[model samples]
Target: MCFRLSAEGTVLSVNRYGAEHLGYERNELVGQSLLRVVHEEDRPSVSRRLAECVVVPDTTTAWEFRKVRKDGSVLWVRERARAMTKPNGEAVLLVVCDDVTERKEVEQHLLEQRAQLRDLRLELSLAEQRERRRIGAGLHDSVGQDLAFARMKLRELEAETLASETRRCVEAIGQHLDEAIRATRTLTFELTSPILYELGLEAAIRNLVDRMGAQDTIRFTVRSSGSDETLPEDLNVILYRACAELLLNVRKHARCSEVEVAIECTEEGIRISVQDDGAGFDAGGAGKGSDRTGGYGLFSIREELQPLGGRFEVDSEPGRGTRAVIVAPRERTAIADAR
Candidate 1:
């Protein structure tokens, strides 16, 4: 459809097809205001764009807006318009419109599907966190407590008189029990650290780095800033997991001795960076099925963040080092309250 409107938005002329398309006769559309057929909700924006075209005269401005037909049905149209001088020494807008209702409908459908998928993923993450907390609590309250009680009873028995051989056997059993208790505690912390829920993301990360650094194979340093408020619980969990993943990849593949992790709050959101002075590989080729740095690979980590309004980036060069950064959006309007 085509239309020629005066600079003041009066419809000077409309093509035969354009008039009939709106259920109007050719003559009936002449001398009408162009805004008459525009959807009420879109009129303001259409008016603004028209003013812009008049200001920038020969430049084409394109946008999608809703137009109302003669029968009062709305139609989505992709419009392209340009203002130009007419032979009568007046300015007019030459407009071309294309039907885009089907495309618009498809786009809306895709957006709804994406929203549904994000909600489902959030539900699953929350469910998984609850399960982790339950198991961690059971390990601490049941098995851990039981083991401690047994150790205490063994100590009480040891205080009594016993033969040398018997005492030695009891001592060995106590040592084994100690090992078991330590292992259980480690597993519990890994499953769900109370520090993460009690403290914020920065504190939890510091604890993780300190614990890992104790191994002595790698030296880890953590620095953070701009973390004045606590993040949503579910968001913290995901951010924690992503940071842990990067650290694991460094431990397993970087083959370097020093690692640095930084957490900061930016205008966009929270940013976490993990850098290692280890064996770096070709990050460019890493996307082409190469993943020397394992643990959900770099590409997989990026793909996972895309749906959560987050970003994962990696910079690396062979024999230099690797730096991985993850940014998680600060908003939690769609997320439910933490359990």
Candidate 2:
């Protein structure tokens, strides 16, 4: 479609195809202002482009905007326009337009699909956290209580005057119960820590580092800056899990003995870093499920964080060190509350 417009944007002539496509007769558009067919919101920009053409004669300008047809339907168009001088020296705009509605619709559709996927991922992560909390609570309240009661009864029996051999047997059983109780507590923490829900991400991370450090020869340290008062409950759970996964990877792969986890709240959002001075691997080729790192765990964290306006990054090299950082916006989005 093509049109010839005067310097003031009045249509002097229009191609038959362009006029008919807009549901107008050639004579109907000849004396009409071209802005009549431009979408209201796009008219201002169209005017500016016209001025640019007049000021820079022969320079072509390209842009995309919506145009309205005679029947009030809208269509996207990619227009290329240039200013030219007629034999009388009057300035005129020569414009060509191509329909781009299909491309625009496809782009919008892809955006909606991406949003749906992000919502689905966040929903799944929340559901998993709920389940873990339920199981952790059950272990702490039910089976843990039962074991503690049994141990108390066995101790009471031992206190009674009995044969030394019988007393020794009771003490042995009590010892076994003690170990079972400790194991249950550790398992509960592993599933989901109450600290994460109660004290926020910082304290929960400190507790996690302490617990994991106690179980291994590695030294773990936690440093926190900025206030976590604005961190949402759901984010706390997600970030805590990511940190745990990164630390686990360090324990399983990094041969270094010292690891540091730092949490800071900055202008952008919350930043969490876990650095391990251990056997590092080539991080360049680490894909979704790489054995060098936590593989699926790292991949999953990246996927989960993206939906929350967050990112997971890893920097490492052979014999150097591994630094894993999780950066997330402090605000919990509407999707996080959808469930």
Candidate 3:
């Protein structure tokens, strides 16, 4: 059990573990600020963090310090917190506090090994993406075959319909069934592009965007001279998602009926530009969910693209339309193809 407290040296709640760990009787620290037990040097930082957290929401922060026990011994604690608004309309902060001094020391010792796995590296990620692509392809090959079989059977059933109207109805049903299978195929590829495995990421993007263009009224294009296109998995995922989000926005918004997508692999890294000749708006305004189509398309696009040390450029004028560019790193494994 953990302890909870108000910012002011008053404890609000204490769980069994907290009481036992602190050598405190059940009544001792209740209704206390809990910070009283925090080491003196750590107090100011703790206070500053608490003050900063008040206005921010869903932010995470952690601080480590020693706490004085009832027996006069000190134990270290790592406290992490987030700002919250309680049901009583009271301003409150929820905290997950732990005695992590020992664990932190152990983690510090193993940092080198752990960093390789937990921290995402671009080149390594691309290799992983290729693997995922392979897996996705295998799934599609196996499941897709089954879907084809089912579709074939459905078509045979449709052929048995004798009456014209009944045959028409059966045909409609078959059409829908085919469409469902197609949707599943799209999902399988979207989940992991086999193209990245067989065709590589660059060609995969070209194929995906080209297919999208063929299906919609959007005018799409890819710009690149040298096609040495290999990006690390982390970067590839970001690039792919950035492109996907941009196209989705155009499809749903940029009512201009035209879109252009460009990919450039430069010495510094990779950059993708997606433009739409549709209605644009002020990028400065708030996009809270107020019937604005979930109000998160652009935000998601930025978040997905930015983490790979990439830069996203947006150029849009209300009448002129919108353009977005994302720049990041490039890897090896360069090969190109048309789908």
- Compute each candidate's TM-score over C-alphas: 0.73, 0.73, 0.49
Put down candidate 1 lDDT per residue, 1-339, tens digits, no spaces: 999988888888899999988889978878988899999999999999998999888899999999999999989999999999877778889999999999999999999887676567556766887799889999999999999999999999899999999999999999999999999999998898778888878888889898888876899998888972657777788788778878888888899989999899865689899999988988887744359756457665665466567888889999999988898888865565322
Over 4 Å off, model 1: 4-13, 31-36, 39-63, 70-72, 80-96, 158-161, 226-230, 253-257, 265-271, 276-331, 337-339
Score each candidate by Cα lDDT. Answer: 0.85, 0.88, 0.67
lDDT of 3 by residue, 1-339 (tens): 365555443567777787888887768777667667777777788778876766675687777766777777766778887776677755566666788768767877798554443233333445565676666777677777777887798778766847988888878877877887787788777777667556665787888878888888777777665554555554566577567767777787778777777777777677778787788766554233231224545554554344344566677767788877787666423211100
lDDT, candidate 3, residue 301?
Answer: 50
Off by over 4 Å in 3: 1-139, 149-180, 286-296, 331-339
Tell me the spans in candidate 2 whose CA falls farther than 4 Å from its real position: 1-19, 22-67, 70-72, 77-98, 254-257, 266-269, 277-296, 314-320, 333-337
Worst 10 residues of 3 by lDDT: 330-339
Error of 1 at 127 (Å): 1.3
Residue-wise C-alpha lDDT for candidate 2, range 124-230, written one tens digit per residue: 88888889999999999999999999988887898799999988888888889999999999899988989988888899989988888988999999988888877
Clashes of 3: 10
**Cα distance off (Å), candidate 1, residue 221:** 1.2
